[model samples]
Target: MSAWLFDLGNTRLKCAPLREDGAPGEAVALPHRREDAAAALAQVLPARFEVAYLASVADPALRLAVLEALGARCRRIAIARTQARFGALRVAYAQPRRLGVDRFLALLAAHARGGAALVCGVGTALTVDLLDGDGLHRGGRIAPSPATMREALHARAPQLPDTGGAYREFAADTDDALASGCEGAALALIERSRAAATELLGRAPPLLLHGGGAAALAAHLPDAIEIPGLVLDGLARWAAVERAAGG
Candidate 1:
């Protein structure tokens, strides 16, 4: 019986099978543009899976498309959702559904590692969530990601091309300036959040980074742990709980 997990983000789709050890196998990522993401999914997925689990943070259209595709190819499919509490992680949101499942899942995965953690996700939006050692979510913030910042700049100014940019400390050119400005903004936000989290928690939490743009920010975040497929890892944890509860 084959089980598969899909993590559909705003710009990319990631999928992999659950290994016997309950870990996701070598995952494959597909960009939403410059490629037919659905076709890639079809090509990569097995002919039929016994069960399929999905976590989506994209638009309704993207979610619908993925559901339609997976419905036909799997014996059963379950979509992960934002919850008030799961495992050791508890949502800070009074209205739990208002929180993004991706964020919740990231928090779950971070807490499972056994300590307070500051989880940062750099995807369509730069999201940071702080989870204490007791699994209490300390809320989080969301801001436009570097790519979004570039796109927004181009959309507003047009003269400043959004593409082709390099990050530099003191940028000498427009490209470098754009690159550095956006990335520096994100780095600054994370650093500030880490400091504030330390004060609130009475101890500094380990910074955990994930998502597509994580690598770009990793160098600047000296001690941040790069956890691959965090959302998927979280999904695996959720699935186990579901299976145990007789879902």
Candidate 2:
């Protein structure tokens, strides 16, 4: 039976085929605008699948629209949720549901990599998670991403350009200063998290970067490993475990 994985976030929806090797195939991203989600999926998705596994962190109405579209093409749909434990990984959240499934899935993917990691997801929001080699989720932080920060500032100030400009240590212009400040803030947080993780774990964890905004920051962090398919990869793992248990 053929299956697919869907990751619906605040800004976009990414779908990919679940391969026989238990991995997610190349992902196709679609804008998750409220009115266009169904139309967008209809244009790109095939007519049928035996199962559709979804991990969503979007508005209810938007999720319903996508679910309606998937229902027409898929025989079964499985929605992923945050869990206190998944295999060896133990979530640090006292209330698992409070933790976004996207972050949980990213932690799952990072733990599968078999080492300590500082996982950063840079999208509508910036998220940083620490996972020990033993599959313990040490918690994380969330804040506005650089783009979101710029957009928020523009929304309030009106005169500040929402986009453009380059990052420099000492920017002389307003545009450059905005870019540097926002991007630097996010970068600084990631570095701080990494440093703290090192102190706690007695070793510096490898930084794993993911999400739409990751590439922009990747250029600045030479040691960071960018895995664009991380969440989908974790979904694949989740599917595998579910299947193994005959779910």
Candidate 3:
């Protein structure tokens, strides 16, 4: 039986299927809306799946809509904050129930890959999660995304113009100025979090950069390891554990 994984994030929804052997198949992304999710699923999934897992960080209404759409076609499994032991990584959330399931799953997935890792997800917001070599989820941080900074500035201040240029290390003029500033701010925040994680872990954890804003910040993060589909990877791992537990 195949396993279907859904990552319901703030800005977008992503879905992918993992074959029985753990190989990822096709993946798709849609806007984070009930109508869009329903339409996308209708277009892509015609047959019933074996197991379905969801990691949502969006509105509860939209999340329910997704669950309703999936219906009785598959065994639906919503990821929750549970005591998960993957290697040596101990989930230490103050209130596991309050923690983002997607973040937790992503950290678990990175731990499954072995060794210390800094799992960074750059989407509507940027998140940096630290996992030690012993597989302990020490902690993480969240900050505004590069695009959000630029957009927010444009929205709040009438004087700031929207400059459609790639983020660079140095801005030649005003247009590039906004781009560089916003991008630099995001980079600095991420780097600071990385440094903190390094200090805690005693070595620079292998960085795993993922999400929409990853490409924009790629130039800024020279030494970090970049990996796409981290959420999908995490969902897949979570599905395996859920299956073993007969959920």
Candidate 4:
């Protein structure tokens, strides 16, 4: 039976299926709007799937809408949670119930890879959650993403032009200046959290980078291991757990 996983994030809804070998199948991204989600689901889900899992950070109303669209197409529909152990890692949230499903899933994936890790999700926002060598979550940080920084600058100072690109080591002009400013800020936030994680874990952990802006930031992160589908891998892992649990 095929497993379907949905990550309902703040900006977009990412959907993917787990192949028989438990790897992520092709992923589809759609706007967070209900209509868009319905349309995307209609196009992606095949007739043979037997199970569905949803990881949503959005409101319950929106989640219900997506479920409504799915409409008994699968035998089971499990909502992703911030619980369950995948190898060494345990979802370590002061309130695990309040933890974002995506963060929880990512930690599971990192633990499955086996080792200390700093899982960074860079999208509309930048979130870094850490898992120790023993797979114990040690908490993390959240900060403005590059686009959020740029948008804030533009919103506050109307004269700045909309811009984005790689930051030069030494910015020479206005464009580079803006890029460097935002890039430096983001890097500082990321590095500081990474440093703290290393100190806590007693060694520099491997950084697993994911999310929409990961590729853009990967070039600048010499300390991180860029993984394009880290979250999807986590989703697939969660699917496996749910199936085993008889859900």
Candidate 5:
């Protein structure tokens, strides 16, 4: 039976074929805006799928619209949710539901690699999560991502451009300064989180970066591992575990 994975975020929706080996195939992304979603998905989805596994952090209306579209082409749909525990991985959130499933799934993917890690998601928002070698969640932080920062600044000041320019310690122009300030703020938080995680774990954990805007920061963090399909990867793991247990 053929299956697929769908990761729906605030800005876009990413879908991929689920291979027999239980990994996501080549991914295709589409903006989740109400007007564009249906047409975009239609162009990418296969004629039919035996199953569809989804993890969504988009608003209810958007999710429902996507679900409606998927239901027409998929035999069964499995939604990914944040849980207190998934095998050995324990969630740090007092209320698991409150933790975005994307972040939780990212932790699951990191834990499955069998090591301590500082997982960072750079998308609509910058999210940092810490996981120990033993698969224990160590909490995390969230802040407006550099892109969001730029957009917000531009919204308030019409003269400020929302995009472009380069990052520098001290920029000579407004565009460069805006870029440096926003990107630098995000980089600073990641560095701080990494330092704290190191102190708490007594060893520096490897950094894992994912999401749409990760490239912006990845250039600066030489050691950071980039996993473009992180959320889908985690969803794949969840799907495998569930299937094995006959869920």
Candidate 6:
């Protein structure tokens, strides 16, 4: 039977099928607008699936729209949430929901892959969460993503056009400066967190990068392993566990 995995973010809604091995297949991305987000999901999704699992950090209204669309064709729809504990991963948050579902899922997926990992998600926001080899979440940090930073800069100074920029070590132009500065900020944070994780864990953990902005960040963090659709992987794992429990 076919099943679907959907990751709803601030700017995009990514949907994909689950392969037999429980990996996400080709992804279909649809832009989500603040003015009218529901239309995007209703327009892009059509096929019926045995089940649909989701992890969302979008507005509640937008989330509802996506779920409604999935409800139309999916026999079962499960919305993944941030739990205090799951499998080998234990959230550091005393109140799990305070932590984004996407972050929790990424940590779960990382733990499932085995070994200690520093999972960094660069998307609407840049989030870094550290998980020890023993499955204990070692806390995390969040900051405005490069894109968000750029947008903020533009908003604050309308003269700085948000569109043009290139990353460089020593930017000679305003565009390059903006690009490098924002990206560098994210990179610096990731590096600092990695260093902290290394000290706390007594060794350096593997760095796992994901989300829309991951590729750009990976270019700078050469050792970082880029993994797409990490949230979906965790959703699949959760679904499998739920199925086993029901049986």
lDDT of each candidate versus the true structure: 0.89, 0.94, 0.77, 0.80, 0.93, 0.86
Q: Pairing residues by index, what is the TM-score of model 1?
A: 0.96
Cα lDDT tens digits for candidate 4, 1-247: 7677788877777888778788888888777676566676777778657777788788787888888776657777788777645556776666688778788888888888987888999877888998888878888888888877888888999777557545887888777888888878878888898888777878889889988778778888876788766777888887877778877
Which runs in model 5 stand beyond 4 Å of their true positions?
Answer: none
User: lDDT ranking from best to worst?
Assistant: 2, 5, 1, 6, 4, 3
Worst 10 residues of 5 by lDDT: 31-40
lDDT agreement of model 5 with the native: 0.93
TM-score of decoy 5: 0.98
Number of the top lDDT candidate: 2
Q: Give candidate 4's error at residue 211 in angstroms.
A: 0.5
lDDT of 1 at 65: 78
Residue 28 lDDT in model 3?
80
**lDDT (Cα, tens digit) per residue for candidate 3, span 64-157:** 8888787756766556554555546587686665667777877877887889898888888888888887778887888888777777888998
Please give the RMSD to the true structure for each candidate, in Å: 1.5, 0.9, 2.1, 2.3, 0.8, 1.8
Higher-scoring candidate on TM-score, 5 or 6: 5
| Model 4 steric clash total | 1
Tens digit of per-residue lDDT, candidate 2, span 1-247: 7999999999989999999998998899998777877789987788887999999999899999999999999999999999999999999999999999999999999999998999999989999999999999999999999999999999999999999999999999999999999999999999999999999999999999999999989989999999998999899999898878776
Question: Over 4 Å off in model 4, which ranges?
Answer: 84-87, 170-173
Clashing pairs in 1: none
Lowest-scoring 10 consecutive residues by lDDT in candidate 6? 33-42
Cα error, residue 156 of model 5, in Å, equals 1.1
